[model samples]
Target: MREQIETADRRRLLSRLAGDYHVQTARRAATFMSRDIVTDMTILAITRANVRQITASPEPVAYTYEGVAGVPADGLRIPVSVYALAKDLGLPYENIRRRVKKLLDAGVCITVDGGVVIPGATVVRQSNLDLIAETQIATEKFVAEAGRFGVTAAQHYRPPTADLPKQIIRLAMNYFLDATTFTAKGMKVDVVAVLVLRAINMANISHVTHDPALAVTYAGMEEILPHEARQPTSVYSVGRFLHLPYETARRAVIRLEERGLVQRGPKGLFVSPDVVTRPDVLEGMLYLVALTEAYLKDLARVGIAYRPNPGSPG
Candidate 1:
């Protein structure tokens, strides 16, 4: 029989897996949205609202990805207002307005009566398709990784009838936002700071999941990874990876270090094991695990049954 992981061990494994997945997805979104992760997030929120509006039906609507992507600009019934955007994103009204204006100027988003909406044409573009495909792959990889640790859906496998890529994307975006918001609030830091910190963590352990030996060793003991196994990464590399400015990355790192969340050495920077095991940080990790579980459950409701690998060590 496979060893059943305790709740605490499950939390640690899921938190790390979720963090890595979201950071990579955000980085890809940033690249697709002209090197601005926030912009991509903003657009995602708007698109989600619009999709909800369009798909509001008393009966089940099996909307395919192509069908939804083909909806005309005028067909977008509900436009997400700037105020709503700001509130949802936990950003200032003026800041959101400015970003909306920039998007309008770039023709990436258009002004409707209530607010702004990304054009259907934009959604159907090659870049957006590539993003969707990449996100799907990432989602699958996350499921597979979780399976290796004996985390699987409670339901039987059932394939989705509709190609609801938009719904999947919306859920993924919500997960990202929830994770970021939870960490930022818990740590008393901003979204950028949360991203910076997560990026650093990802850099340090990016190789663990790929190596079977390392993955098995690190599964429930991530907080106690040996110093030699943890890779030290620089602010410059983190900045480049996240498409953040050098100063922004540097300042975030400094802030983290001041809070005893990170440490700098002769080679580079790394988050120490002690810091990872802090009560507050562990709380955040548990929260992430909860969010991830909810996400998987939602996927099942959407008709995508995720099963753990049967051959995986129990």
Candidate 2:
């Protein structure tokens, strides 16, 4: 019998899984902020504001909308306009206009001089904080499980001692936002539809911890030529996962089918094989791989080898 993972190995695996969780939840958060559901463009707008915060001087700058006074120390405050955000994300003017209106009306965004901004009030709401706190709790549980497995950091590994979870979250948010922008422009598909595709495609690996067999089967399909991972998922499941309306998720999937990005499989819906090899899709894959690799590398600092089990999916 193969030896079980040691303490160090489990720790490393936990780190890698933590990286994966950050990416997944960041994508979910990007799509579903607060009670107000938003389109891809709106997601981009939020990301743009966050990016400003990430790159701002004086680390951990608090972000507040324009005209908001007395910003907190932790706020990475920045103002972003719909037009500029639209141009940056390659979204159409009209579409962004409509979405921005919806976002503002929903109090998820604030408007400023000929532009809009994500406000401190909105960001600091107890609900949002609770969500992040919940994510942290989940991450701790994951690490504890890893410890149980005797996983330890690699001998040469150096763990990031400062705000590691927050760092990972920031990285993940930027990655998914950039990827969505790329897909929207390259595939000529609405960002919302692309988001749906992403969620569907990810259903397989996302469930590995709960259902290892299912994950392996899905992984096997993905490994076969001309076959993508098969996820027989419904709009309700996708919508619930992304916090989108059922109809909205359904329509997005329909749009994806219309655009040939996905197909109706007997299993339900799967990404189209034809599009799997397309340059746009490949480019997106490369981007995702790069991001994950970087995260793994960071995990390696603390003695964790990046050895993933072939029998399981993540």
Off by over 4 Å in 1: 1-8, 53-76, 154-156, 221-223, 303-314
* TM-score of decoy 2: 0.64
- Report lDDT per candidate: 0.74, 0.53
> What is candidate 1's lDDT per residue for 10-124, written digit by digit as tens?
5566667788987887798888776876677778777767776555432234443446642435464478899998777777789778888888898888887877888777788
What's the residue-level lDDT of 80 in candidate 2?
70
TM per candidate: 0.85, 0.64
Residue 144 in model 1: lDDT: 69
Give the alpha carbon lDDT tens digit for every residue of 204-289 in model 2: 33454334344223232133223543446777877777777788889999888887777776767766556666777766555544
Candidate 2: count the clashes. 26
Model 1 vs. true fold: TM = 0.85
